[model samples]
Target: MRMSELSRRSGVSVPTIKYYLREGLLPAGRQLSATQAEYDENHLRRLRLIRALIGVRGLSVSTTREVLGALAEDTADTHRLLGLTLGAIQVAGETEPDSPEPAEVDALIEKLGWNVHGSAPARATLAETLASLRTLGSPLDWRVLLPYARLAEQTAVLDLDQLEGIEDPLEVAERALLLTVLLEPALMALRRMAQENESARRHADGTAD
Candidate 1:
């Protein structure tokens, strides 16, 4: 397809596509003539992934470029590829923010036997979130999250099952990123509704707010 066709098909502006090409986010299409280049389905797929990273996930252009680079590398191991992706997406070089819940979070993770690396960004995020909850005066018992962790484990199993049939590396990477970035808010919304329903059931008195 020509530039115009590529733009129309990918729903990206021609100028924006050219910018991506210049920035090395999207590889240049095949040269057909002095002024023409042809794009194929792979280009289209890459464009979609770029849009998802920048538009949906709100990653800066440089970060998106890094992620695409990681995805492009040949890696037969999905776990290692995912680790690379997470590392690329996470903000880097920040001193660890002081958090009071690191020990509790570490203990909970240990009890659950999660296979995450000690330096995983999610470990720091969990600790910071727990600390924030306490600072907000809504501290929760770590034991209360055991069931939630079990639910997450089941969901992870389902996710891995879905990925089992996918043989294409790019497809696997894009699907995993989409699931993590897009489904998080949907999951939180469902939890909120469930909490409302449970609160109503458990506190049935007329005076209950």
Candidate 2:
């Protein structure tokens, strides 16, 4: 197919496809003539993957490049690459210029007395996320995030339970990719539903008062 067909099929514009080709994110097509290039199925698949990584997962171009490179490697390396990508997206607690360390996060975990393993990525993710939230001026302290963290943990467990039954490696990878892409919207809708329910309850309680 020509660039136009590739663009139409992949839902990426011609200029953006050209830009990706220039950046070496997508491989250059075969030069069919002086001014035309022919693309193939590989290009179409790659363009879709790139769109998911950038548009859905919110990964930066550099990160997406690294991820695509990893995916292109031998199958043995793909799992490790996925782990690295997940770690990159995990939030660590906030840090400010000369800001004090998040002793509160540690304290909260300790108070909860949960047996968190040393060097657990979840801890680091929570710390980073809290840090980022603080940077964004979240007034509620670390305690406020505990419920959300518990909900996240439950959701992760459910997701793993569902994934455990899948047999095909490629299917597993595709499912993971799709889930990572779509989870944000799913979570947002759940939160919005909860908010509406809470508002209804509050209004009913006020009437009783």
- Candidate that would win on lDDT: 1
lDDT tens string, model 2, 117-142? 55557666565666666668874576
Candidate-wise lDDT, in order? 0.79, 0.70
lDDT of 1 by residue, 1-209 (tens): 88899899989999999999999999989999999999998898888878878887789999898888877774587887777755557653322456557777677888899887888877677777777778789987778778888999998897677778887666776777787788888889999988888887788653444
- On the 0 to 100 scale, the lDDT of residue 79 in model 2 is 50
Off by over 4 Å in 1: 91-100, 137-141, 204-209
Give the TM-score comparing model 1 with the true structure, all chains together. 0.85
Top model by TM-score, which number?
1
Q: What TM-score do all the candidates reach, one by one?
A: 0.85, 0.62
C-alpha root-mean-square deviation, candidate 2 = 5.4
Candidate 2 overall lDDT versus native: 0.70
